[model samples]
Target: MIKGDSLMFRGRLRGTALWGGSLLLAGCMLNIFLQAASLGMKFGAVADWVARYPALYLAGSLFLFFLLLLFAALVPGGYPGPLLAVAVVVLLGTADNRKLATTGEPLFPWDLMLLKNAGEMRHITRGMLSPLWIAIAAALIVLLLYGMRKLPKVRMRLTWRLLLGGVSAALAGGFLFVVGSGSSLASSLHYENLYWNQKVNYTQNGFLFAFAGNLHQNVMEKPDGYSREAILRIAAKYGGNGSEAANPAPTGGTQAEQDAKMPDILFMMDEAFFDPTRLPGYSFSADPLVFIHGAAKSSPSGYLLSPEFGGNTANVEFEALTGLSMYFLNDGSVPFQQRLVKMSSLPSIVSILKQRGYAALALHPFDDTFYNRNRVYPMLGFDRFTSEKDLPKAARMTPGGYISDLAAVQEAVRELRASKGPAFLHLVTMQNHFPFTSGKNGPNTIAVSGGKEAYRKELETYAQDTKLTDEALAELAKELKELPRRTVAVFWGDHLPALSAGIYAEAGWDAKPRLKHETKLMLLANFDIGAEGTGTLSPAFLGPEVFRRAGLAEPPFYQLLDRVKAELPGLSGSVRIGSGGNEIRKLTPEQEALLSDYRLVEYDLLEGKQYSAKLMF
Candidate 1:
C-alpha cells in the first residue's frame, strides 16, 4: 500500500472515532439529564440546578458511562451502547413516575412482582397510560434507532473487542460495588447521610444511586446489643407466665380436662371496612355500619392501628397470626416474599391453637397465590387453606369482582360446623378490594357531599360495599348465636381504602402521614367470657387479646404481646396508640421505653438468633 493512501485512511478512521466518542458522551449526558429531570419534576421543579451538585452528577454519569461502554464492547456494530442506555433511563423514569402517582410511593424492586400479574390489574393500569409518557417514549425510540444507524462502525479485531468488553465489565462492577454497596464507596460518592425515606433520598441523589441505597436498605438492620442474653432478659421482663400458664377452662373441669367447653374461635378481616363516621363532618343516611356500632357496644371494639393502608393485606394477616410487627422491619419488604421462606415455626395463633388440639383452617375468597399465602399459610401452621380453587364458584358472590364478605362468613361457618372439635378458622374477606367500580352502586344510601365528581362517585361506591360488609358481619353473628356450641368472633379491617387525594382534602382532615392508618376492630362472643376490654388494639395484639378475653391461656410469645399491648394499645408503621387509646404521631420517652423492649424481642424472633424462641415461640 502507498504511504499517502495509508495516511489518508488513518486520518478518516481518527475522524470517525472522534465523532463516535462525541455522540456517546452526548447520549450519556442526555440520559443523565432526563433522569434528574424526571425525579425533580416529582417535587415540582426542573433539575437545572443539578449542575451545582457536580459530584452527584459525576457519580451518576460515570455509572451510566460504564454501562454504555460495556454495551458498546459486546455489540460489534456502531454505538448500540448509547442507544440502550437512553432506553434504560427512559424506562426507569417512566416506571418511577407511574408508581409514585398510583401508590404514593417510589418504585422499588419488590413492586416488580405486581407487573407479573398486570393482566389482573386492568383497573389500575387503564388510567396509567399517560400521553406525556407515550410522547417521551416515542421520542426516545426515534433517537435510539437514528443513533444506532447513523453512527460510524468501529473496525476492531475480535480479541481487542473482547478485551475491551472485559475491562468495561470490571469497571461497571467496581462502580456498582462502590455506589450500590452503601458503604465506603457510597460514602466517598457523597451518599453518607442516607435514610430509608425513599422520596427524600431519591430527590437528593438521582434515581440510580437512591435505588442502590434501597437495595442495601432491604437487608434488615440488627439492633445494637441484640443477642440471646438480651432477648431472654427482655422476654423474662414481659413474658408474664410460662406457656404452661392455664387459661380459663371451657365447660371442662380441670385445665388438663379437655371437653365441650373450648369455643370455636373465628377471625375475619373485612377488606376496607371502617366506620364512615370516622371521617370528619361525614354523615351517612341510616348509618350503614349501624349493626357494627351496636355490636361494638356489646363487645370489645375500637379502632385498630394497622401497619399498612389501602393494600398489603398479607402483612396485616402476618402480624395477627404470628404476632410480629412491620414497624421494625425494612419498609416495603413483604414478609411472604422475604421471611416466610426462612421461617420454620412462625409462632402463630394457628400454631397455638393446633397445640390445643384445634384444627387451624384458613379461608380466602381469592387465588391462593396472590400473596403466596397458599405456601405461607401452611408455614404459619394452618392445617388447611381453602382458596377459590377449593370453593364452588357458583356459590361465590363477587359484588365488585371480589368475593362478598357474606360468602366468606358462610364458608367459615360451614368449616366450623364440619370440625368435630374446636376450630381456629381465619377468614380474610375481600368484598371491598379497591377500584370500587364493580357491580351496581346499590341504592346509593350513603352520599359523599364534598369532593371532585369522580372522587365523590368512588366514595359512594366504597360506602355501599362497606355496608354490605357490615351486613355480612351481622349475619355471621346471628349464625354463631344459633350454634349449639359457644363461639368467639373477632372482626377487623385490614386497612383503609385508597381513596383519592381530593376526598381527603375535602374532608378537612389532618394531613399527617399516619392519619389514615387507623381501622375499626370488634370482638364478639356468643357466650359470656367475663367483661371484655374495649379500646384500640394493634393487629399483633389482636390474636393474643382474643385468647385473653376468651379466657384462653396464651403461649409465652403472646404473653409478652399482652404486656406490650397494655402499654401501647395500638401500634402501626406511622402511628402509636397510648393506653388511653389516643393516636399520637410521636412517641414520648416513656412510650419509647415500652416500645424499645418490644422491638428488641421482635428482632430476636424475626431477624436475630432464636434465643427467646424456646421461651416465647
Candidate 2:
C-alpha cells in the first residue's frame, strides 16, 4: 500500500536503530568485562583465571543494570540501561584503582563517607585517566546518544507503565534487602569468610562481597569472657570504688586555691612529625629537631608508642582521648566510623576536664566531616568544635597540599585566648602528613649525609618539612609564653612519616615495624607543674598523666594507668617500648594481668553493658 520512496525511508530508519542499539549493548558488556578483568589483575590473577571467573562479570552486570533500571523508573527516562551500566563500571573501576594504589587495599563502604567530603578527598591521590578506557567510554557514550534518537519507542498505556515501573523498583529493593541479610551466607562461604585481617577477606571474596561482609561485622560484641562481677573485682584492686563522687578538694589547698592555679591545658597532635635522627644509619647536616631537643632537656619528654604508623591518626587520637587501645578492637577498624556510632557516653579526657569546669574545645585544621568527627565530637563531650570551616580564613596550605602547622597553631592560640575560663583544647595539625616526595615539598633545605641518590631527595624533603614543623613549635612556644593565663601544652607526634621501602632497607629498618612505630612526646607548661620520669608511655596513659600534671582531679582509671605505666611504659596494638627499647615481645605474666584488666574496663565502656562505667566514672 506504500510508495517505493516511503518504504525505503522506513527500511533505513529500522536498520539504523538496529545497528545503534547493537553497538550500545555491546559497549556496556565490554565495559563490565574490562572492569572485572582489571580488578582480577590487581590481585595477580592471570588471563586464564579471569576467563574462568564468569560469575564476577555476571553479578556486576546484573546489579549495575538493576540500579540503572531503578534510576530510570524514578525519572522520565525510558531505559538508560547501557549508558548507566557503562558509567558504573568506569566510576567503580577508577575509584578502586586509585584506592589500591594509595592504601594498598580495595575500597570499602566506609570510604563512601570520604568521597562525600571534598576536603578529605585532598588527602587521597587522584589517578590519571587511562587512554584505552577513556577512548572506549567515549565511543560508548556516542553510540548510546545515537541509539537513543533512532530506537523505536514502545508506547504503553499510562497505567501499565506505572505498574511496570513500580515492579522494577520493587525488584531492585528486594535484591538490596537480600544482600543486607545475606551475612550468614557469607560467613559460611569458603575463602570469603570474614576474619581479623580484612585484606585477606577482600582478596578471597572480591571487593563487592567482602564489603558487604564487613557491614555485618560492624556490630561489636562483648569480649570472650565478660561479667559485671569480674569487672567490679578488677576495679576494686585499683582502689576505684566505682562511684561518681564529686572531686574532693586538693589535699594541700581549698577549691578556691585550686581554681587560682588551674591552667588552660592543650593537647596538640602533630601529624607525621617525628625525630628522624632515630634512623640507624642516617645523619643530617644539622640537628633537625633542635627545638624539641631543647624542650626535652627541661620538660617531660620521651618516645611514645603509637598504635599506628604513617596514617590512622584517628586511632592515636582515640587512645589518647579515651584510654581505650585499638589493639583490642578489630584490626584497622575506625572507631569514629564504627564503634563510636553506638556509644552515647565516652569517658574521654574532654569529659573528665569538663567535669572540673573546663570548657572542652576540639580543633582540627581539616574538614569537620572527615571520619565523622563532627558527629563523634558531641559524643565525646566537646563544648564546641572548630574545624577549617570555622577558621577566620580558609586554611593556609603547605606545598604538600595540607594545612600548615604554623597556621594551625595560630588558630589554636586564637581559640584559647577567646575562651572565658579554664579550657581543655585538643588540636590536630596537618602540615607533616604523608607522601614525602619532591613534588610535595618546596625545596630540599636540609642535607642528608648518607643514602642512595634515589632516597636522598625524598628523605631531604621529609627532613625539611619536619624542620618547618619544629620551627612552628618554637613559634607556638613563644606565643604561649605571652598568654596571661597559665597554660600547659602537650605536644606529640601522631606517628612517623611513611618513607619509601628502599629508604627503610638502606637504614636497616626493614624487618622492624615496632621500631618504626616510635614517635616523640613532650609535655611542657609555662608554669612549673611537676611531672617526672618520662621514658615512654602509651597514648592511653598520656591523658591521665596530663590531667595529673595540670592539677585536675584524676579520672577513675588513673590508678590503673599508673600501675600499667610502672611495668609497661609504652604499649599499643602492635609494639611495646620498655626500659630496654622497642620490641615485639611477649607480655610477662604481670603485664598480662594488667592488660586483662585494661581490656575488661575498655570492653565495658565501648562494647558491653554500661554497668561498669557507672561505677567507674
Candidate 3:
C-alpha cells in the first residue's frame, strides 16, 4: 500500500510539470506573436530585435508571460484563460496597427477612452475593418471557443487553486508596479521609457512594455518651486494690474466705444487642409487653394506649427482656444478626453470673450461625443454647443458622408446673425476628414503628377477635397464682407492629411520634423487690422495674437503669452521656431527666464492651485 501511494504521488507531480511547461511555452509564443503584430506582423523584424537586445526582449516576454499566467490562474479551467488573453492582445494589437497607419502614432492608454464613442466614430473607422477581416475574426473566435470547450479541465483542490492564483497575481502586479513606478529595479534592468516618440519606443522596446510605460503618464509635472508665492510673482510681472497695456484699445475709440467696435470673431478650423503646391517635385492640375493663396497675400497668414500630425484635431483646437501649449504636456495624451472632462471650468479664449460680453458658441459638424467634446465645451465656457445632430439633414450633407464645410460655414453665419451681442463662433469642419479613397467625393477633379503610382489616388482625392474647402472659404469671405458688423475669421488646418507616408517621404517632408507639423494659417477680416506678411507661430500664441490684432483687451495670461511669443514664436513638442523663423536648439538666458515664467504660470493654471485664475482670466 505504501509503495502504491508513492507511485501515485510521483505520477501526479509529472503531470503537473508537463501542464505547467506547456502553459509557459504557450504564453511565450503569444507574447512573441503580439510583439511581431505590433511591428506589422514582421517576424523577421522580431528576430532582429531579439538578436540586437536579447535581455530587454527576454524581460518583456517574461512580463507578458507572467500576466498570462495570472489570467490562467483566474479560471477553474486554464484553457479558456489563455484564449481570453489572446483575444485581448489581438484586439489591442489590431487597434494599434490601425491607429499607426492612420495617425502615424501608436495607441496610447488615453486612446482607450475613445472606445466609448466607437459607434459615433464609424466615419473614421469605417473602412479600417472590412467584411472579410470581420469574418476571419469571427471564425477565429468561434474556433477558439470550440477548442476551449473540448480541452480537458484540470481539477485542483480549492486551497491549492487559491494559492496558485494569489501567487501569480502578486507576481504580475509586482512586476508592473516596479516597472511603471520607475523604481531602481526598472532602472537597473535598463528599461527605457521613451514616451516622447512612441513609434520608435514600441519598435525598440516590446509593444507591451512600451504601452505599459505610458499607463502612469503624469501629463504635466508641477514646475520646480511651484508655489502660490511664485505664481503671484509671475502674475505681478505680466498681469499688469488687469490693465490692457500689452494690447491697448484701438486709437480711434473710447473704452466702451472700443468694446462696441470689437469685431465678431469666427474661427474655422478646417480638416486636413494644406497647400499641396508646397510639395516639391509635384504639380497639380490646378491650384487647389487658389482663394486661400489670394487671401493669404493680404492677411496675417503663415504656417501654423500644429502640435499634431495626421489626427487628434482636438489638441490643435485646445491650443488655439486655451492658449495652452501641448509642449508642456505628455506627448500622447488628449487633454479633452483625459483632463478637461475632470475640470469644472478652464481659462480660455472662450471664457475671456464671454467675460467681454461676447456670446461664446462652438460648432462641429461631427458627433459631440467624440473626444468628449459635448462635455468639454461647456467647461471651456461656451454658452452654446452645436453638433451634427443639431443640424438639419441638408446642412449635414457631404459626398464623404461627413458634413460639408460650406454647410458648416452657413450654420456659423446663421448663428452669428441670430446672436444679439458680439459672437465668438468656433466652427470645426469635417469635410476633409481622412480615408481619402477614390470616388469618395464623386470623381476627383484635381490631377496629380510626379509621385508614386500607389499614392496617386489618395493625392488626387485629398487635393479635390481641399479645393472644395477653398471654395467654402471663398464663400465665407464673401459673406463676411457683406455682414453689417465687422467680422474677423481665423481659418487654419488642424494638421496635414495622412496621404500615405510615401508621399511625405517622396517630398522629403519626413526629413524635417517641422514640415510634418506645419499647416496653413490665415487671419481674414472685413476691416483691415493692418496685419500682413507670412510668419510662423505656435497655435498657443495664436489666441493672444488674435486678441491683439482684434484690438481687444487681453487677459493677463494672454499678455504673458504675448511676451513669450516675441521670444519663442513657434513651439511644439518636437521643435521650437524662435523669432525670425529660426529653430532654437538652445535658449539664451533671457529666453530661459521667459520660458521658466511661462512654465510656472502654465503649471499653476493647469496642474497647480488656482492662484492665478482670477488674476489671469
**Candidate 2 lDDT by residue in tens digits, 137-204:** 68867877876676555343567557756876776555444455664432343324454666555554
Q: What lDDT does each candidate get? A: 0.71, 0.70, 0.81
lDDT of 1 by residue, 189-296 (tens): 577435446666666676667766565454356887777677767767755333442332344465435635567899998877776666764555657787887876
lDDT of 3 by residue, 1-617 (tens): 99999999998788777767767776677667767767877899989987877776777667666666666778777667767877887788778877887787888888888888877666687666657668968987997889789976666777877787788788777877876898887776667888766788788777767788888776677778889888778888875454423233345656557556778999999988888788887888989999988877678889888899989999999999988889888668788987888888888888777766788999998888888899999999998999988885734334547888988988899998888768899999888887787766567888988877767778888888888889889999899888878889988899998777888999898879888888888888888776675488888887887777877777788888988898889888778988889888998999889888888877777777767777677
Candidate 1 has which clashing residue pairs, if any?
Answer: 251-261
Each prediction's TM-score against the native?
0.85, 0.80, 0.90
For model 2, what is the alpha-carbon lDDT of residue 269? 92
Q: How big is the positional error of residue 89 in model 2, measured in Å on the Cα after superposition?
A: 4.9
Q: List pairs with backbone clashes in candidate 2.
A: 242-615
Which residue runs does candidate 3 get wrong by more than 4 Å?
A: 1-19, 37-40, 51-56, 73-76, 128-139, 155-164, 242-259, 392-400
RMSD (CA, Å), candidate 2 to true, equals: 5.2
Backbone clashes, each candidate: 1, 1, 0
Q: Give the C-alpha lDDT of model 1.
A: 0.71
How large is the C-alpha RMSD of every model relative to the true structure? 4.1, 5.2, 3.4
